[model samples]
Target: MMHHLGKVALPVYFWLFVTWLFLPLFVMAAMGFRDSNFVAFPIQSWTTDWYQSVLDDREILASLWVSLQVAVLSTILGLGIGTPMAFMVARFHGVWRAILITIIVMPAFIPIVVSAIALRMFIGNFGIQTGLVAIAFGHAVSSVPFVVVMLLTRLNSMSPNLADAARDLGADEFIIFFRVVLPYLSPALFGAFMFCMLLSFEDFTRSFFLGSFDPTFPVLLFARLRFGFDPGLAAISTLVLVATIALGIYAERFTRKRTAPAKQGRLAASGDDKNV
Candidate 1:
């Protein structure tokens, strides 16, 4: 009886955990269709008025556009900075290698509030009063570590002989990178890009600290939430969630297309080498 109770308890706990994790999102999504101005249970008559209100608000529209711009720019900057760092860390080992990795990963380990405040001060002290510039800069710095960590893991898993083989065949660095490394790293790159972009879009702390009057969508939504719970905000959230899910699926498919052939060939070659 005790043993059966334990088994039943585990499944119950697992279902409870899953429910707890998604219950808020489910409630929030429900509020988007709920007909009340306030987010409440027993969600009153269903309507599309909340979504229309989101579209009608100029501030919401502007903030959402800014969020997209910032996310795109920050992710692009992270890609440029993270690729070289990942390549170097994965390829080289020295006294400085660990230090480099620690530095890159420290942002992720540190409290995001602390990072936001620190970035706000640093950028402010430079006399940079611009909103988007500060926001994008903060996002790029904070997100670079995520890109480096993911890309480095992918790079480390790759065949070391590939670069050497390319060099032996008289392929230049650019050719080898475009032909071999990029194909292998496509999935990691896609994941990193999407992660950074989504983070930038959803980040409230840094956006709150970095922007003066022009806050990103999350920051703006939070500010509004302080007044009262708005069903329109729920509508915005549901839209963002749906869009992000769609984008993630598209990116996964794109990554698979780029990685499939290379992955099969590499596995075949690796098996042949082991057999030899």
Candidate 2:
């Protein structure tokens, strides 16, 4: 009886949750079509002129370029550093492992504003000025913890026997890692990459403190909002939402492809053994 009640209630709860989550987004999307100059609750009529204006704005374009550079660079650096660290933590058993993992994850707990301020002070002392490089470094620091956690979860789910079998077959360490481990990890890596990209793109506090001349997307958006809310901002947000959803779908497909074949192969082999 309880199970049936839960099943019936689940759909209603899910719809409520979805509506709660997407209400603001829907409002923003609606505002994107407003024909008026000022931002208003009830949009009069549909118009795409604001989107066109945003497209023609040189500052927005430049800010987007800067944001793209920072997000890409930060994701690359985070992946390069975090993946190995995750593997070590997942596979190794030692006292130092926990300590090291905790240290790697500490950055996530640190407030972004505090981290940004510390970086600014540290870099200033070394005569390193704020710009794209500073922003990239700050983003990398913040993003690496997430990458580590995601990759660690993936690594933990993998069977230890697979790695041992690879070693017994005389595969070298590099080849075993690349062939046996990386394929299973691709989905997680893609997820981490997308998360890092979104975080870097949407960051504002760090950018405000560390961004000197080159501002990121969020920083630019904040500046635009200060002047007054524009319909173009809504359009840009809608684009971001669509892109994120598309990336999530692609990652899900990739994960299914990677795991499905192995399961099928096992089932086929089991059936063959039974026939014998």
Candidate 3:
């Protein structure tokens, strides 16, 4: 009786928690469509004017362009640095490897605000005015740790025998890595890229500190929100939410497609050996 009750309670609690988390998002989305200049709960009438207004806002567009440049550059740079570090950490076993991984991931555990402040002070001393380059550098620093951790986890779970098999087949080190390890790491790489992109997009504290001459999207959004409530802000937020959801779905599909063949190949190999 107790076991059955516990099983029933688990799903009920899960649904409740899910609802709790998404309720506010739903509310905000609805408010975005409200036919009013100011954001108000329990929207009076539905209209798309706010979204149109946001689309026409020049400052918002410029901020979005700045954000896109930063996010893309930062994610690319993080992947370049993080992928090799992840491979090393996953493939090698040594005291130095562990120490290196620890050092690489240490920045992630630090408070974002603290890291931002430190970056601000450092950049200030160099007389580097805050702008696109500063934002990209700050975002890359913050996101690399996440990419390394995610890729390392994926690499560790992969079978080392793949590399060994390639070597046994007379493949050189570079060829074996490119043919074997690269395919295996594809899903994790895509996931890390998406994560880094999102981190760069939604970052507020780091952008606030590192941004001076031009602001990123989030920084601009914050500045707009400080003056007064705008329904257009809600519209922008909703658009961002929808974009994030779409990207998440796309990433899932990409990962599944990349990994499915590897899993099926393993199964087929086991079946062949059994038949033999």
Candidates in order have lDDT scores of 0.85, 0.81, 0.84
The TM-score, computed over Cα atoms with residue i paired to residue i, of candidate 2 is 0.84
Q: Which sections of candidate 3 miss by over 4 Å?
A: 124-127, 159-161, 164-170, 264-276
Q: Candidates' TM-scores?
A: 0.87, 0.84, 0.87
Model 1 misplaced regions, further than 4 Å: 1-7, 249-264, 271-276
CA RMSD per model (angstroms): 3.0, 4.3, 3.5
RMSD of candidate 2 to the true fold?
4.3
Model 2 bad stretches (over 4 Å) = 1-13, 256-276
lDDT of 1 by residue, 1-276 (tens): 889878898799999999998898888888899987667889759999888888988998999999999999899898989988898788668868888899888988889889888888887677997588888888999889889988987676677688888899999999999998887788889889988898898888888888878778888889888888778889988888889888878877886676667667676655544412
* lDDT, model 2, position 49: 81
**Candidate 1: how many backbone clashes?**
0
Write the number of the candidate with greater TM-score, choosing between 1 and 2.
1
**Superior by lDDT: candidate 1 or candidate 2:** 1
- Whose lDDT is higher: candidate 1's or candidate 3's? 1
Candidates ranked, most accurate by lDDT first = 1, 3, 2
